[model samples]
Target: MVGCARVVNQTPTLPIKGESYVVLPFENYTETPYAGYRVASILEGVLASKGYNLIPRVWSINERELAVEEIEKLKESAVKNGARYIVHGSVNEFRYKTGLDGEPAVSITIFVYDAKENKVVKNVTVSGSGWVHESLGTLTQKLLNRAF
Candidate 1:
């Protein structure tokens, strides 16, 4: 498989009601520069569009190598900023497929955590390929919706 994502815990639903969220910077695993920022921006836009208040801040820690202390600090900051939840993510893949079609492709993993409880709520991995003519942002949004 090109990509996959799952929550570490048993939470099956996200807090989709009247809750606020903070989106941390996503770690970009691919060679494409700014891919991580791109994913983070998209997530922020989508969440805001869904009627969630977004905490206007970017947690600039390395998501892949975050330590317990760093995570605690982040959670505390989010709580202080009045965010009910925070989202961390990684851009696992961000490039066009190398073939005749050269389709735009993206793979990402997102983790949602409860700011007050300092525990994960849900995580999801989603990958998608778009037609040669489609924009990366549109394809990413479609894939994200599927994951949501």
Candidate 2:
């Protein structure tokens, strides 16, 4: 219960215009230690490919624990970095299926926060499994495409 923040009724399509944003490292709910960072990195590239102005990883060090602490101080940090928004979330699942024909799969939730207002502007969950021959990164990209 802070600021005028509330989840929007609908998630916006990607490449949000006229906004400089930062992709904060995401939480990894999965057992894989690097899954969160891996996905967050991929997401940053995807957003940039789609024409979004994303802050570089060098600016924040891609650390989840640090991001959590920084959320309380997001307004000041965002202002310093010239970022109007922050993207962060969790990787619920990141692994291949357990079967004779295992396929890469991932479940992730993404959120866009209005840094200046300290409010979430959008939230989206995306989950999917790829063909047996697909790589994890490729599968993740497909899932993100489906999400946004």
Candidate 3:
């Protein structure tokens, strides 16, 4: 929320125009890591199609390659790879529940930060009851629009 800002409610769509960017894998907070990675891959492809530069996350740490014992070592490696804008995204919580109220509930939160600015470029959560699944793609695209 500084120099320039805009929000486009179209998820899973490419941008009309702009600068390049790198989209990091979103941290999966669900019961399965696979679910998290699946979403990340989708996000990556969408952004890539927009002509933004992207950095593959696993190419550096190799998933669990760095433990608490190797923080320092990994730092150097990440830098050597010529990373400028590091995308630290996460899906901290996802809940789908149906109770006595007979209404289903689902929520997904996505965050994108600008490494250089050291500020949260975008922070928002999308939620709905039944049929919320249809909005996931739309929500992600909305996040990316603000991110770039």
Candidate number of the best TM-score: 2
Q: Per-residue lDDT tens digits of candidate 2, residues 58-99?
A: 334443344456644654565578888778788888898798
Per-residue lDDT for 99-144 in model 1, tens only? 8877788888899988667788888888777787767788888777
Worst 10-residue stretch by lDDT in candidate 3? 1-10
Which residue ranges in model 2 land beyond 4 Å of their true spot? Answer: 1-15, 58-67, 70-78
Q: In angstroms, how far off is 26's CA in candidate 1?
A: 0.5
Please state every model's RMSD to the true fold in angstroms.
Answer: 5.2, 8.4, 8.5
Encode model 3's per-residue lDDT on 75-133: one tens digit a residue.
23444564444444445433344454333232345554444555555544544443434
Candidate 2 C-alpha error for residue 6, in Å = 27
Superposition error at 142 for model 3 (Å): 8.8
Provide the lDDT at 76 for model 2: 59
Off by over 4 Å in 3: 1-20, 59-79, 92-107, 128-148
Candidate ordering by TM-score (highest first): 2, 1, 3
Give the Å error, residue 26, model 3. Answer: 2.4
Clashes of each: 0, 0, 1
Give the local distance difference test score of model 3: 0.45
> Candidate 3, 54: how far from true, in Å?
1.2
The pairs that clash in candidate 2 are none
